[model samples]
Target: MSTTRHELLTAFDLLLAPERFKDYGPNGLQVEGRTTIRKIVSGVTASRALIEAAIHADADAIFVHHGLFWRGQDGRVTGWMRQRLGLLLGDDVNLFAYHLPLDAHPELGNNAQLGLQLGLVAHAGSAGRFGEQEIGFLGAPEDGATFTSGKKLAAHVERVLKRPVTLIEGQRPIKNVAWCTGGAQGYFEAAIAAGADAFITGEISEPQAHYARETGVSFLACGHHATERYGAPAVAAHVAAQLGLAHEFIDIDNPA
Candidate 1:
């Protein structure tokens, strides 16, 4: 089975709502490939390496969290940028990147999917002032299950990502927590201000270390790639289901 590029892009545009965000790169389609797609690949970034992998996999379309054409970027396509764009263009592969929009969706967004991974039910219409929706959320387990401590929560995260978690300073067991998807260390204040007991996000910058320590909040540094892979797959699965297109999610793993 196949779908036209225009048709697929239309479905995805409505699903992601790229207009809601001021993104670093072009949100929807970056490269126009074949008009019809039979297979789609999803990843965290359109890095040269990942793009190559998608090409090798014979993907017609690639979906990602970080796309090309970032904010404060040069208009000229040169060096790494030039090489990446060349690869996609030369191969006739279409690229679709979703940043904040993927992070904001209630059921299909990166933040929401991350929360669901850890058993969170997000509140409706709780997007922040930055138009950043809440990714981490508060929820009790379906069977009244519990995570005994910050250490335990960190351990669970480690188990899920298969990476060692960098535990930030915090105390006690937790059942109520909050989180955001992607590079959202800046949203820690939002989570804390929301009265959350703990917070989790994908990548953490240097300054966030001091912020977490001073705020008396526990932080966990799960690799960015590991944290974000879920949302796109979730979206792809739904899109494939909705439009009845054949979908295969290829994981081009990166230990970022």
Candidate 2:
């Protein structure tokens, strides 16, 4: 079964509501390909490897969290950019990407998925949003649960993500946690101000160590790619199921 590219994009727009976000890049379709899309390949990024893999899979469309164009990127499509674009253009495969929209969606977003993986729940009474455009989320363990210590929380996160986590231990137990996936260290201070016992994000900057020490709030830096790998595939799968199209999620590993 196949669906028109317009129908797929419309479904995504209705699901994500891209207009609600001021994202770093364009949200919906980036590169135009065949009007009829049968199979879609979803991944974390639109790197050369992912593009090649999609082409090999004979995908009619490529859906990703990270796409080729960004707000301040160079206009010239040369070097690596040229190669990636050439692959999609040559094969006439559609490229669809969603940035902040993918992160902020309450159900199928990166933050929500990461929280689910870690067994965190967004309570109704708490003010769940923080940071620019309220992209970050504040949540707690399910059913009034709390980690006995930061180390225990870190261990759980590491086990769930299947990767080593860089933890800045706090002076107190972790009860309420805040998180924003994918290079969201900048939101740490906001998380702290929002009264989070701990903050989790994809990357940590140099200053966050000191903040964690002084503020008594734990900090965890999971891998940027690791934290963001779920949203694109989840969104794609929903679209596929709705449109009766085939979908495959391809993970191109990146340790950073």
Candidate 3:
């Protein structure tokens, strides 16, 4: 049994609690299509490639972490933006997106999911106030894995995310960690204040490297797309299972 577009939106609103976040873009139903959804496609970003792939897959809707119409971007629908919106409209496919909510969700969030994948236990208490939203997560090595070196942790992240990870190593062993997926390098300072031995994020800036070196807190830039790839798929799978609709996660490669 397929679910209506409204039903899907309500489900996600309840699950991710979009109103709780002040995100860059809208969190649900960016583009409207058919009233009922039968097939859903999930991706990290709602790029032209991903949109085309979803069209090929005969998807009724496309769910993404990075949706169009960011905070500072021009509101005009021209050029590439127009092309992308046109494709979805022409194909009659809906677009759904969740940004900060996907990262902050306790159970299926990007940060939480990444921590579990890397054999770390989520510890909300570890990290203090971070930004307008507590999207980042703090974690510690799982029981029995008392210690993890910076090199080993980076290697494990690289292996799991299937991408090369850059590390700014610290002197101490990595006993506790803080992470937030996708271009969240600025959170490194918060991680240090939280007493995290290491901080992991999708991308890093010039200042972050200098901060890591001086602060003695290890930092990892683990590929923005790679780190955020899990959350949308997880959300789509859950939505599909809940609504009894078919789901597919289409991966479009982006090194950044």
On TM-score, the candidate that comes out on top is 2
For model 1, the superposed segments whose C-alpha errors exceed 4 Å read 123-143
Runs in model 3 deviating more than 4 A are 124-132, 146-148
lDDT (Cα) of model 1: 0.75
Q: Please provide TM-scores, in order, for all candidate models, with all chains considered together.
A: 0.89, 0.98, 0.95
Candidate ordering by TM-score (highest first)? 2, 3, 1
Pairs of residues clashing in candidate 1: 24-70, 136-179
Candidate 1, poorest ten consecutive residues by summed lDDT: 126-135
Which has the higher lDDT value, candidate number 1 or candidate number 3? Answer: 3
Pairs that clash in candidate 3? none
- Kindly list the per-residue Cα lDDT of model 2 for residues 142-229, writing each as its tens digit: 7688899889999999999999999999997888899999899999999999989999999999999999999999999999999998
Ranking by lDDT: 2, 3, 1
Question: Which candidate would rank higher by TM-score, 1 or 3?
Answer: 3
